[model samples]
Target: MAALTIFWDDLSVETALDFCEYLVRSEDYKLRDLAIWIQGSGGPIDELDGSIGSLVALWSWFKSFREQGLPGVPLGARAAYSVITGRPLDSPLEEGSRLVGESVAHYVFKVILSLDPTAHWAVRAKSGRIAHAWDNTPGISMDGGKHFGPAVGFFTNYPDRLSSNYHNAYAAREAWDDTGLLQSVELLYLAGLPSRPRSTSTTESILSPLLRDDHVGSGHREEIPIAQEMPASITNNGPVSAGAEELIFASVGADVSRLDQAAPLDELAVASVLAELGFVSADGQSVSAVTLLSHGVQVQNVDGFALVETHVAGGRLRGLFLEPMRPSEKEWKSITDAFSALGEKLPAHLANER
Candidate 1:
């Protein structure tokens, strides 16, 4: 095959670096605010914490360019920066921002594609949302081939790759330019830099001596908050690890309300209740009680927490799955004890086998 032509290859590295500095300097807090907004709204993507962590790492990487100069940045990152900066200025802000976001998605596309691209599709296939959507809804196309086209044909023929959770987020967009999440995040990453340059120049430019330094005035830089003083919650960017007791209580909270329902609770009803609690079957649909008891169900997004039914001396028991680490055996026992406290013991005969 002929060598592929990268459109942004011709853009000067200095210009791209300036753009990166500008974005980081101008956009960081707004990005955090957007992340908080998404978390508060319970948006489709559950990786806000992960995204924040990535942003933090990216900030450190960008800062390294100052001490090490241009050689410090990876070639891929340089290309990525050029790609982001080369986006057409005349395009709609939403469209431009989305393109910029995709360029910086080293966290997802680059990492996945670097590992056998074809096999990564299997990972997406196994995703709860993608698998559920694929299995149940045959008509709605998950293929990005038409929408994303050939622009991102690196991993596969453009548009051939299935839509990621990031793509699905657009289906439920509430705010205008919800697609700009990545752009805001990129700005937030830049926001971590020092407010004013150490030099005599009034403008704050990244990497001491690069091109024109007048773009970001000292006054403008002063307006951006110092990243260090931000709240721990914003900086940490991970879900608060709820205690096992709290997790179990929240997980089973619906069971109490279901007691008054007309029909007796069966395995399927139990599965639906678990589904409401954010547990899903292997195929990502509403889990069945049989599956929960037999195979166990997975909790989406947040790490840890699985539903398992066990045969104990008293009877068949259902509770959160635990291991030696993570929640530890003691933490798992705490969940089980909490369940027992709730009086949820079931007879062995009620336990369904696969």
Candidate 2:
């Protein structure tokens, strides 16, 4: 069926992190994958995600179109992955294939990010018992499995989607079209406006989750139980092309790549944010937890990699970016209790040990 996954499509980790400031540790797998790419010299990590399987699906896929023992992405998939990530695409090398490690990771990350969050909202699948695990939504059938995202162009953001009639009829009928709200998005001249014509509103724009520098100081304090949902195993797909990756590996790399690089005071600024978040210090002060929960501490991937990602700052706003996985109220309380305990002042004897 036409399994729509818009609920969490644009659900940015940064937005989820902003949902509770530094109080609730925002978890983001996407950023973690990006970090690994930077660490790999703009290449895919050799390790496999144990949650998915011991066999490295991505590595196997990349190796198929091996060029000089290095697999590269094709033009079509290359362009697609770039567009979906909101980046520009470049042509593949005619003489040799491009290295797809970085681009493929980014593409997969975006798709998984969109669908994984759906688990948190699968209340109906709980079987009347609460569990920290993920249960697929009843109506959200990802028929193509791992290949579905690429097939539907979800990875590349290709304009052509599978025809609605080709989808499972039963699932389509049972689907929730946002109760007709989504259908309301139509082109209009508006009551009064200039000669410009543009898509007025969309579920992607008006309703998409938003994240920004201003959002860094946002959200209230709360405990967020770490989520560890494993995505369904994806069989290997064939190789695609590669591009220049991100603007420059240097921007995301450990070295800032320039003498005039901006200072990483973003962490200190976040430390101040942690103080506001009520993290108690070892000396009976607060936000010491911020120090403990620095950039790569929270929100990990299936491989236990933290999604502590860095991005190019074009708007003069430089800082860490990330998301949150919503927890059940019970889980929330449990985490909150843990934080509350951590917030407690250290005992007299343990002061030095701390």
Candidate 3:
């Protein structure tokens, strides 16, 4: 009753990301073997049995893994995060952990860029949604939840992973089956091919609903009646190692009077206030109510904060939202303070001596 030994090393928790990178680079030689193992072994990795018939098919799988973030990724990403940062994937990821995550993502992006300059068709087709969400241009409305890039998603998590079966499958096999060849092939796949930008329509379809009036709290939808008091904060920045930056955009709604005490700040007034706060209109023009309604006035500062001033329910509700793209703690606090100051200066809070 000796423990069984396997020929190929199983993609384990510690090596998941590295193994995926191996798989991607060495698909020609390794993927076929993996397919054989999955098909013949009748084991847990079989969910992907018919999926890896060719390199193109494999790329599609990677594409889905990146875009959808299949279930098994969190633990794998957690494991990778620990290995990369030398820290446990604990809750309340501090600034150091956040930067490590960004560094990993930036490295992955650099890897994708280093690819062979010719992208696979599947990669090209899926390129529209590949950019990090935080890379959005000011004034443009697009999905901010898309943190996955071509190969970065694989680093975050491995997919179709069944825990027990992986251990059993590896123990059952008995050959040395080195991954040297696979590693070379994976390197070629990742570094040899670069993606081309896709059509604008593909991007438009994925725009954020938060920026779309027709989607939520719109005329047809039940209005989220303006609250009498502003909530201290509403943030989606969770503890996940990666994708946190993209989630940095926080929506805070408040009721404050204008500093002028003349009228509530309109889009133009908002733009002017933003200018004072060091944010420039995305298009270098005064924002009109029509433009604000269409695409919230996207103002970006050199300091990594983006603000989108929006009104919902046909102007009955005003919003003060902050989208910080990789801000330091001090920068975040500064941005929030600016928001508070902006709130006090607009309309009712301003005291006027008449």
Candidate 4:
């Protein structure tokens, strides 16, 4: 399976590195000393150790953000209203900045920075911090996609891959930090940028003598490279490439260890497995092309992913069908094992699929 791609607002690499430092310190204070030792800041600001996983993730995110052509966007005025009302209509403004809703998200906790301010989707501040804040929504659109809300869009009008990336990142973090929630994030500003050489007389940094003076210049801007095809190796890339000899390997998150076990299977067999797994029923529409259902399930290519229903205990259950993506040569066993593993870790959401 392909590595999940997330669109991020392209910013200076210096800023990205700064953010990396913040990620390091936030995740492990011990690393703060290591960063200082390595002269990550060229001097000690706080305090550190040797680990650096969070820093690497942030740095990788910066590189991938440009590769994937992602941009940061803030939510609109009426999106929160629409999410709550279940209507397509925009909400009316109230008192300018506060969109009086219970349990609305804290803007800072957003996967991306919150840049817009609308009363309809406004969230209250923590107590004693002044409840409401307002600002203008800087409108930016690409290929006609919503900037925020329940259905925020991603990449060249792609179905929100950022959401998947966010989920995967969250899972990765959960795998890493088993203690509790890690908050109070630090962000890096774009401090150094590489510039094109103007003359041979240019100098270098004292910290890293190999570094170019132009790269650390006062005004530096360079076009970030694009890497849209990076996911081809692991992505089904539209089961369009399917042939009698080809097998689609559907993958969830960063786990693709089972992909080598792939083998081709027809639509009927795939559908039957889903049915047996309780993801779909025999009466449901026949599997063909990718089709989104009102029930939040989608049948796509030879490999598909969906949010399916599973009853747990006396109530109901909803879990991500990561199991479906793990197809193998032993087709029947793969299907059964997929569903069985899923049953072992069924998620607890009983509400209608999102």
Question: lDDT per residue, candidate 1, 55-160, as tens digits?
Answer: 3333233223222432312323322322343433332322323332333332332222222222111111112442221221101011332111122222111121
* Model 2 poorest ten-residue lDDT run: 345-354
Q: Write the per-residue lDDT of candidate 2 for residues 1-354, one digit (tens) a residue.
A: 222121122212433233223212322322242334323443333333321221133333333433233332234443211223232323343112222333343334333334332212111132222221222221122223222211212211111122242334323444323332122111011111123423222223110122223433225423332322222221122111121011211112233444125333333444443344333332333343244333333321221111223332432222333221232234223333432343242110101101
Off by over 4 Å in 3: 1-41, 44-82, 85-117, 120-264, 278-291, 295-302, 305-309, 313-317, 324-326, 348-354
Best by TM-score: 3
Judged by whole-model lDDT over C-alpha atoms, candidate 4 comes out at: 0.26
- Residues 173-211 of candidate 3 have per-residue lDDT tens digits of 333222321232342233323234222122221112223
C-alpha lDDT of all candidate models, in order: 0.30, 0.27, 0.33, 0.26
Q: Per-residue alpha-carbon lDDT of model 4 for 1-354, expressed as tens digits?
A: 222211222222333334323322232222222232234423321211111112232323323332433222113432322222232223232211112110011211122222111212211112221111111121122222323322221111121123453454445443322122222121111111112212221122122321334432323222223322212213333332221121222323312233223222233333445555444322345432122112234432222333332211112111223323422334334444654454344311111112
Model 3 lowest lDDT segment of ten: 1-10
> Once model 2 is optimally superposed onto the true structure by TM-score, how far is the C-alpha of residue 15 displaced, in angstroms?
14
User: Model 2's lDDT to the true fold?
Assistant: 0.27
Model 2 stretches with alpha carbons more than 4 Å out: 1-61, 68-79, 89-286, 289-354
lDDT of 1 at 301: 15
lDDT of 1 at 337: 54
Cα displacement (angstroms), candidate 1, residue 265, comes to 15
Candidate 1, RMSD to the unseen true structure:
20.5
